[model samples]
Structures are given as C-alpha cells and as structure tokens.
Target: KRVGEDLNRHVTTDGSKAEWDAQDVGLMNQVNFDESTMPIPLCSCTGVPRQCYKWGNGGWQSSCCTTTLSLYPLPQMPNKRHARMGGRKMSGSVFTRLLSRLAADGHDLSIPLDLKNYWAKHGTNRYITIK
Candidate 1:
C-alpha cells in the first residue's frame, strides 16, 4: 500500500547539496556505535543521562532516573493508514534525533566545522537555527 515512487532528495547544508535516498535502508544502524542509544535531543528522556516525568496539568518534569512518557503518543488506529503514517513519522523523528546528536558531537569527523572548532565545542546551541 505504499504510495508514489521514491525520489532522490537532499537538503543543502553549509553550501553544498547532494542527492540522498529517501529511504533509510538501515543506515542508522551502520553508523551508530555502542553509545548511540539516546533518541530524543532535548528534554529529559531515557537512553540519555537525564530523567523526565509528565505532570498532571500536561507538562514534562525531570526526576532522577525515571522513564518519563512525556509527549510520547500512544499507538492509535482508525485504520491501517493512520498507523502507517504514525510509524513513519516516529521512525523519521528517531533518525533525525540520531543525526542531530552525531552532528553535534562531531563524531563524523569528515565534515569540517563551519563556525567553531569541534574540539572546544560542548552543549547545545539554543540560538542556532537550522534551515
């Protein structure tokens, strides 16, 4: 029940734009190491060194080492289509989360740092906006 044909897609970073396959094809696993368990970027979450919790009013709170279910959507189904869409989005988000962490950590040392040196870099830049 897959829809249209897959097309080559790419997002320009820095200044260069290269073609990339739309499908993941298990690339994340190939690139991931033993320390790549964390999925979420910010806000306390499991797989990382932070703990999070959901509040009664509808917000996330940090605990110590608890697995917080904040903002995580339960599996919903009206039909197969909805489920497929949800799964696709979730997987896509996870892939993005991994890429972001890798990029931030400068683990893929092939690309040169644009604005600052990777050796002296630490922590997330809150003001940095990605196109």
Candidate 2:
C-alpha cells in the first residue's frame, strides 16, 4: 500500500532557473546553412567540419563527436550494484541500462537518497542536485 502524508499532498514543479523566452528557445534551433564552417562564439569546434557543437571536453577535446572522458563514479550503493560488470563503473551508461530497476530510495546508505527523507533528517544541496 502507498504510504505517507507527504506522498498524498499535491506538489507543483519548481520554477525554472533559466526562465528562457521564445527568442532564447529559438536560438538553440537555428539552422546552419554552412556545412564548411560554424558560427563564432556558438561553436568553438576544432574537430569536424559543419559541426555546430560548442566546446569539447572543457575545450581540450577536438570535437563532441569523439570522447575519451569518463564521468565521475556513481553515488555510493549497496553491494552487487554492478555484479555483472565486476565492480567497475559503467561510466555514462547509468541510464543506458535496459534493466527495469536502477536506483532506490537510498534509505540504507551512509548517504541516503530517500528524497522525502533523503533528508530533512540530514541536509540540502546533495550530490544528485549538483550540476
């Protein structure tokens, strides 16, 4: 059975921090007519022609088309999280797993992620919320 008064209460989505207008949204969808080059400031590409990408791997990489970067490791989890992968991290593929289950409420960890209780009992600005 479903539980908790918090779960029963209605909640609205938080205000967007970007607060983009129509013009700002359109800026992202602009068509690039030139295949040989991209516009300045918008693209700092050094990798491929006709690429509209901004910067690659903090400006050190050639293009977004190729990547040698590995993302930071996943949040702490219980044992056997990646049993099939032999304890090695799955890199950027956390969401790429085809399995039906991936994460949990984190109530049992040193850093619990129960969201509701994740914790009013502990603190704010947790790792998951960081950019």
Among the numbered candidates, top TM-score falls to 1
With a 3 Å backbone cut-off (N, CA, C), the pairs that clash in candidate 2 are: none
TM-score for each predicted model, relative to the true structure: 0.20, 0.15
Give the runs in model 2 whose Cα sits over 4 Å from its true position. Answer: 1-18, 21-33, 39-131
- Candidate 2 residues 1-131, lDDT tens each? 35645542334333222221111323233332222442221212222222222222212111111122212222332444432111111111211110111112222222211111010122222112112
Per-residue error for 76 in candidate 1, Å, reads: 1.1
What lDDT score is found at residue 2 in candidate 2? 56
Question: How much is the lDDT of residue 18 in candidate 2?
Answer: 23
Q: Candidate 1 clash total?
A: 0
